[model samples]
Target: MSTNRELLFKYRKEGISDAVIYFALEECNGFDHLLLSQNLDKDIKDENRFVDAMNHYINGEMIEYVFNKAYFLSKHFYVDNNVLIPRQETEQLVLNSAKLIREMFGDKPIKIADVCTGSGAIGISIADVFKNNKVVLTDISNEALSVAKKNGEGLNNVSYLQGDMLEPLIKNDEKLDVILCNPPYIEDIKTIDEKTWKQEPHLALIAMPCTLFYEKVLKDFRRIMNEKYLLAFEIGEDMEEALTKLVKQYCEDAEFYFEKDMYDKTRFLYIKSANSYTNN
Candidate 1:
């Protein structure tokens, strides 16, 4: 029988970070750290679960997937292998969109759509924050949509649509005040690490030509978007110049801006129609 400290030391020696080890323990035991401290030398009760989680981590599996839950905007969202795990950087998308909605819509009910909504983290979090706004979460994969829907089960204002980008909106004649997307921007699937390639869904990770979805949306944007609309995207850093060109060609009347993430890398795109924005 191995003691908790001994097992943790083994994991540490295998290059598992302290944060990941601690998170795994907390997830398994649910914050009984005092007992954990006193019983450092005691045999762990559910040692097999810990072993399995650590083994998965050692094999390059994401901790969030091991726990089957991810935290976004300070809320816990259910996640699975079927969908991409929520990322910390995407929280900015929720924040930026929410702020713009409040400032632009100003208490009026607004329609928003989150295209390529994986796990519903972006759309659902925005809907959760803006209680008065209705959000439609759309994805091309039915499996991904199922995960998104599960995460949004408690929210009344959130709906799910399965389709490619804005196609469902165009088919349904739905017009939106805001459209947010975190589409597949990885230009090469080979560039992804082996663990990610094996564990995550390929459809959600690879975007051949890299800008296909963005280009598609821009071409058909007029069909589903209102006169005054905001388009927010989580883009790859390498996409800034090309995306700027796309905006110039298609969004001639829109003001486009690229925002930097915490590392100062340009990773977010914000395009707002010039004619629609009037200071309230």
Candidate 2:
């Protein structure tokens, strides 16, 4: 005997966003005008699912995880605790990476890899956008790879590999024109909100030395890089100076570019050697 307004109020009281509450309600029960109308407060019939969903939300479970699917670039991607939830900021990563791919490689065939490809959101979304590119999605966790594979189903241009970063690519003798990664760049897990930290996979969120994985990618995986390689990362906002030093140590000649997110945080890094590609 719960009215829609009551349910909405309940969710808002628990600090859930109106959009997320709406999404949860819609997923639980199809939207009805009476449900959203202030004047027509009536008990919702058979809203057990809605009640359960609300409980989950109130308990700090991410709405996307509750739904088991997330919308990325207008596509639905399967997700769970095995992977990190896709964020709007990462959509920017996809958009810019797609633009760069088109600019550097044209419409011709190209090889790319998505490292730390949780839920296959980045690699799958990229492949869906750039049809001519063959993308290999790599994750160290088998469970994460399984989740990614489910999201990547029916995408013929995508392949899955289970190894840390570019290790699978190196073993397969694959050289890529681009390598994109949303690595674990969090220097301290304690800094994150308890609610979110409880729900997301810790391995996908925290890195011991923060730049440990990034450093490994630049140093050990240099063999699998193509002539006109583009290396991009969704970086921690404060990693510019540290990453700059690492880039100098491992890839001193590569041109480095940093991109700010909508909040003006330094959120991305683009490293490439245009001169090598142009000369060749």
Candidate 3:
């Protein structure tokens, strides 16, 4: 086996990016180049410690697991195999939901529920923005709940529950003012990229189909949503037409329909229940 010293030299010569270098330092425990290149103005020799770090990196010990940190807005949250890593798309869901809340309610405190609250990313972010508003974060997995519990512990006006999405809200008698979800929307699990399918939690990323959860949410809204409640959901790619059909079928009188995160392939949909109620 080549010595760590020789390996370090080769990787540095290859010129790896800073991010990969960061993981190399993190996963390898220590890189020999930085550790060994201590002399002021002394240029390290070719095929030095840096090369070894990159070699170890490509051999793949550093990425044995998924990324452990997820950044949302200003803060960082811890994630692991048991919890689905929060994605930028889900963050968009939260931001768009908050915007709808402000547009409809004008800064007033309202009850909000975030279903399938993995890592508590969506709910925590929404709660952070609406300081006075209350948020209930719900999930079915205890492992996922544990992650949310830690992420949400110090956030003001945030609540955590371990149960199926709507079940916990039913027990709490919360007819929410807003309901936001990034539920498992992929209908055919095989259709997703192999890398993501392997890395993410299936329970958190897969469901009967793209529109399945929306159908279930329709039932949930019928049971728990009130005239004043607003519902927002993140849909799979190209799912707006089908999801819109479902919403129109069930929520015919909703005041207006809006799409958020327009930059994304599939945007989130917000239906204003109060608008529907008032239109009657």
The CA root-mean-square deviation of candidate 2, after full C-alpha superposition on the true structure, stands at 3.1
Tell me the spans in candidate 2 whose CA falls farther than 4 Å from its real position: 1-10, 13-15, 30-46, 276-280
Tens digits of lDDT, candidate 1, 1-280 = 6777787798889888877886677666554557677777777667788889988888778988999978788788888899988888999988987888777777888899999998999998898888888899999999999999888888899888889888898888888899999999898777898878888888888888889899988988888877888888999889999998999999898888999999999989999988555743
What would the per-residue lDDT of candidate 2 be over residues 143-183, giving only the tens digit for each residue? 99999999888889999999877778889999788899999
Ranking the candidates on TM-score from highest down gives 1, 2, 3
Error of 2 at 260 (Å): 0.6
Global lDDT scores for all candidate models: 0.86, 0.84, 0.70
Q: Write the per-residue lDDT of candidate 3 for residues 55-167, one digit (tens) a residue.
A: 55455423323336556666678887666767767777777677667777775667888888888888888888788988999999999988898888778799888887688
Better of 1 and 3 by lDDT: 1
* Candidate 3, run of 10 with poorest lDDT: 39-48
Task: For candidate 2, give the lDDT of residue 109.
Answer: 88
Better of 2 and 3 by TM-score: 2
On the 0 to 100 scale, the lDDT of residue 86 in model 3 is 73
Of 1 and 3, the candidate ahead on TM-score is 1
